[model samples]
Target: MHAVLPVAKPIRELHDLRPSDLGPGILASTEPVVLRGLVAAWPMVAAACASADAADAYLRRFYRDATVNAMLGPPEIDGRFFYNENLDGFNFAPVRVRLDKVLDELGRYRGVEHQPAIYVGSTTIDTCLPGFHDENRIDLGGRDALGSIWIGNRTRIAAHYDLPDNLACVVAGRRRFTLFPPQQVSNLYIGPLDLTPAGQAISLVDFLQPDLERFPRFALAMEHALAVDLAPGDALFIPSMWWHHIQALEDFNVLVNYWWRQSPDYMDTPMNALMHALMSVRDLPPEQRKAWQALFRHYVFEADEDTFAHIPPAARRALAPMDGDSVRSIRAQLLKRMNR
Candidate 1:
C-alpha cells in the first residue's frame, strides 16, 4: 500500500561534494542536488557520529545565553508547523528563551510518551551560537552571504519557497526534505502571502495527512516532487523559488544554512515586481492583461542574448543592461511614478 502512494522521483546525488563544486555560479544554478557526505567531517556531525548524547554535549558548548526566538505547538498537531484553521495566524505560539534552556528541555523529553512540538527556526548563528561560523564558514569569494540555524525536536516546516539560493547542512540527528519545482507553485495550494504563519507563504496541504478531499490538486504537485532523507553531515543545495518541506525525524535536530542572492546585491527581489503586478495588473481586462503578459515576456522573462541585439545602443537607454547607478536611477523614477 505504501509503495502505491505518489512520491517524487529520486533526486540525483553526488559523492565527495566539495566547496569547489559549490562555486557561486554552480550554487546559483536552478538545478538542485543532494551532496552526500558533504559535511561528514564537520565537528557537530562528528560528535553525533559518536553518539546523540555526545552531539548534545558538543552543541551545549556553543549555546550563547542570548534569548532566542522559538515556537511551541500542541502535540496533537504532530510536529507539523503551520497556520491555524482560519488561516489568520499560526497555530504555534512564539517564545524567547536561552538557547541552553531549550537544549536542556529537549534532554528532559528523552523518554516522554508525548511532548509538545517546539522549534527554534531561522535564528542567526552569530546571535544563537556566537563562534559557530569560525569553523563552518564557506568561502564564497568574499560575497556577503547570511547564515541561520534551526534547532528543534521533531518538527516540520510546511512547504515554502525562499527568495534566494540556499545550502543547508544537517549538523545533528536526521532530516528529510521534500522539494517541488517552482512551476508547481499553483498546484501546491499555497496559503495567503500577506498573511503568512512564518515570513514566507506555506502550502496548505499537510504532507503527513494530506486532506485529499479538499486539496485534490496537491496530488498533481506530489507527482513532480522529490524527497530525500539526510543524515548528519549531509547537505542539500536548494535553488531559489524551489518549494521545500522539511521534517526532523529525530527527537532533537539541528540544521544550518547559508542564503545568498545569485544576482548582485544592488538589485531588489523580483517579488516586489510580483506584488506590484498583483495590485496593478492582475485585475485588468482580458485583452489588456494579455498585452501586459507579452510585454513582460519580451522585456523581463526572455533571455538577454538577442532581445536587444537589433536596437542601437544609444537609442536603447532603458532597454540596455544596467549597472548599480543605472538601477538606482530607474528605481527613483519608478518611485516618482508610483507617487503620482
Candidate 2:
C-alpha cells in the first residue's frame, strides 16, 4: 500500500486573465501562479473538450508526418517514468516513431484497464507542428521563448528543476502540479547529478508511493509543497529552479509550454560550475575546504566593488564586469587548463 501524503497548499490563481496579462512582472515572479481559463478559448482546447478523437484529429492536421522521440513503458511501471530498480538506467525505452502512429496507439488503448505508458515529450512545436502556433499562441512580452509540446497518456514525471522560467498551458485532459521552493533542495533527496533520467537531476522520492522510511527528509519537503490542478485552457507560470512534479491526470493529455531564461544566452549553465566544484573542492582536506569556502564567499557569492578595490582597474581583467568577449576568454582559458 502507498503511504498517504499530507495535503498540499493550493497554488495562487489569477482569473479572467488574457494573453497580454502575462507581462514582465508575472514572468519574473519567483512564485508559481495559476492563470485559469488563459488558453480555454483556444481551438485545440475546444476540440479536446468535444472528444479525445477530435483532439487527435486537430493535432494530426498540423503534423506533417514528423517522427518524434517517445518514451514507452509497460503497464507494470504504472505510468511513473523513473530509473529501474538498480538505478543504472531508465524504466522506459525511448523510441522514434511517427506522431500520428503515437496518437493511433493512444487511441487503441483508450478505455483499457491497464494501458502502456506512451509519452511524446519536449518536441519542438514549430519543428513538428509547423502552423499550430499560428492559431494557438501566448504572448510572452517579447521574451525569446522556446515552445514545446508534451503528448502522453496518464503519466507522472519525477520532480525536477529547470533553469529556464516556464509557462505551461494545458490544451487537453487535466494535469496536477506539485511544487516545492528552490530552498527545499536538501530535503528532496535528489538523485545523482551526473546521471539523471531526464536532462536535469530529479527527486528520487516517488510521489504516488513515497518511501518515507528510506527518504525521511522528504517529509520536511512535503511540508512546504504547494499543488494545483490545471484543466484544459488553464496555464501555470513556474519560475526558474522551483522543483515541480507533474502528472497527466487523464488518459489523453496535451500540454504546450514555453521556456525562457532570464540570463543572457552567452552565459554558461551553472551546472558546469557545480560539476567542477565537485571535482576540485568537494574532496579537499577539511581546513583547505573551509579556506576555499571563505574565498568563494569573498569573490563569487558576496562579490561587489569592494572585492577588487585593492587592485588597479586595468589589472582586474577577470574581476571587472563581464561581457560576451570576457565570457568567451574565460571559457577558453578554463578549457585550455582542463584539457591539460
Each model's TM-score? Answer: 0.92, 0.97
With a 3 Å backbone cut-off (N, CA, C), the pairs that clash in candidate 1 are 8-225
Which candidate number maximizes lDDT?
2
Model 1 C-alpha lDDT per residue in residues 170-275, reported as the tens digit of each score: 9888999999999999899988878876789899987887887788788889899998999988889899999999999988898989888868878888878889
Give the per-residue Cα lDDT of candidate 1 at 296.
Answer: 94
Q: Write the per-residue lDDT of candidate 2 for residues 1-340, one digit (tens) a residue.
A: 3466678899999999887678877899999999999998889999999999999999999989899999999999999999999988999999999999999999999889899999999999999999998989788989999999999999999999999999999999999999999999999999989888768999999888889889887888998999999999999999999999999998999999999999998999999999999999999999999999999999899999999999999899989988899999999999999999
Model 2, runs deviating above 4 Å: 1-4
Residue 184 displacement (Å), model 2? 0.9
In the predicted model 2, the residue pairs found to clash are: 40-233
